[model samples]
Target: MHLHCYSWTGAGDDLRREGERRPPLPPGDLAAFRASPLPPMRTCDWLLKPATRIDTSPPTVTEAQTWLADRYGTAEPSFLHPADEARIGLDLRLKIAEESLAGGTDVLWGIWLKAGGFICLVVVCCSPNRHADYPCPCRLTSP
Candidate 1:
């Protein structure tokens, strides 16, 4: 399947492919995050703000894993079915909430996966500006 990325700032949608330039991240203060014992984390801004909201009814682990596989054509054996909300940092959650309130994104739709000794987020994102949905996969590491 052909994959694409989009810039969705509530403005016109600009579509691009994997080798092309990436879309700009919505307004957010990732630097505002205070120091912590965890190693430095890395991820694009779009991952924090999913274009679509997650379902109210939690998906089973198997369902989440299947979704991951279907979207990416592969799924990690350690993929966590439902997200471990408690694993996310409080400060980060606050930042995401603030950004969402500012209309930066709809919500965070994510699942957890264990990579080696670290835990990461495998999230889904799309272009809010266009009718077409381009699902993108991103990883977010947490303390």
Candidate 2:
């Protein structure tokens, strides 16, 4: 698998400046991320935000299906099934509310996987107010 690392200041101006001034991160830098506990500091202002992209090796459609089925216990994961979309949306709303109550921004992570003509998108949001819990994979789960 290959991973890409980048950061966003959560502002439009910073994003535009980043596109104009910064080059892509070195592949070795991403490798270092997996081996080291602390990531290197960003040299530019726009590259200091929190975000990342992970790209896995291409897999066959059947492989993707099997992986999802194993991870979620169903061929159709909740994120992929239309019937569960509303529930996901509501969960995000509640998460945002909880974050607001805790004096933190509503931090959300989006995962997009594509391989062998199959695509899956997952959005996991963390609420700053919540304590550590196994079922919640948000970064703020721990104090």
Candidate 3:
């Protein structure tokens, strides 16, 4: 079995492609930032849709990150270049999660399970403080 927690932009770019860190907004730019249209968090519905079952209850963000860290052997995951396939692991997950809570792209988190090289299950988690434009799917009783 292969397991990992992955994070990506809703637009489907590699996590490392977040480009340069965003600069601090000037006082006058506050209005622009406020007026900017932010999309609802990308729930990674593609992963959720085909499930025979989905466990809405997910581990906490720290728990999820730790899971990856333990498995990948990285105690402190710093933002670095993505692997050849653009797969996201602990580092990108942490960065995206932080950016999401700070009013950037609505990042989503999920635990991915693969067995025999085939994806088998996914567990979606609620965003930090439930800061989502839509209801928290993770809190749903049913898929």
Candidate 4:
């Protein structure tokens, strides 16, 4: 499985490209994501750097999500609103519940408001689901 995330524009070009699959975010998030600030390049340079050799085999989604949750507590409120659950017309409630057992890793993002930087972490750690857009396949529950 592959993962992709977005970092704000303030990041150095080389820094943003450090990861294997850093997919560009949607237009709306892109603007906000790019406007964000990043920590000192040197501080995270080692982490952001690309690996010497690509590893086609990576940890499973569940393993990755577990690692992330352990490192960063479930960041649910940022990507999903409480109201989106009941109000949503789709039948994703069950999926949401299951995915959230460990944490909201399937569809999660990291946003830095003060500095204005964003990174999207894709959770390919679970059974494949087509809903790439977080909070399900439809627009945010019209609330």
Give the alpha carbon lDDT tens digit for every residue of 1-143 in model 2: 11122221222222234333432354223223332222222322112223333222113323332332343333234233445544555446444534442342222322222221122222222222232111222121222
Q: Give the TM-score of candidate 1.
A: 0.21
Residue clash pairs of candidate 1: 61-81
Decreasing lDDT order of the candidates: 3, 4, 1, 2
Estimate the overall C-alpha local distance difference test score of candidate 4. Answer: 0.32
Best model number under TM-score: 3
TM-score of each: 0.21, 0.22, 0.28, 0.27
lDDT for predicted candidate 2 compared with the true structure: 0.28
**How do the residues 60-137 of candidate 1 rate in per-residue lDDT, one tens digit apiece?**
333333333343222234444424544663346545644542442333323334432223223222333222243332
Instruction: Mark the regions of model 3 whose C-alpha exceeds 4 Å error after superposition.
Output: 1-52, 67-89, 101-143
lDDT of 4 by residue, 1-143 (tens): 23322222232242454322332333233322222233212211212222221112134444444444432333333323335433642235334523653442334433332233333333332222333323221222231
* Global Cα lDDT for candidate 3: 0.32
| lDDT, model 1 | 0.31
- The weakest ten consecutive residues by lDDT in model 1 span 3-12
Which rank order by TM-score, best down to worst?
A: 3, 4, 2, 1
- How far does residue 127 in candidate 4 sit from its true spot (Å)? 10
lDDT of 4 at 45: 21
Q: Once superposed on the true structure, which residue ranges of model 2 sit more than 4 Å away at CA?
A: 1-31, 34-79, 90-102, 110-143
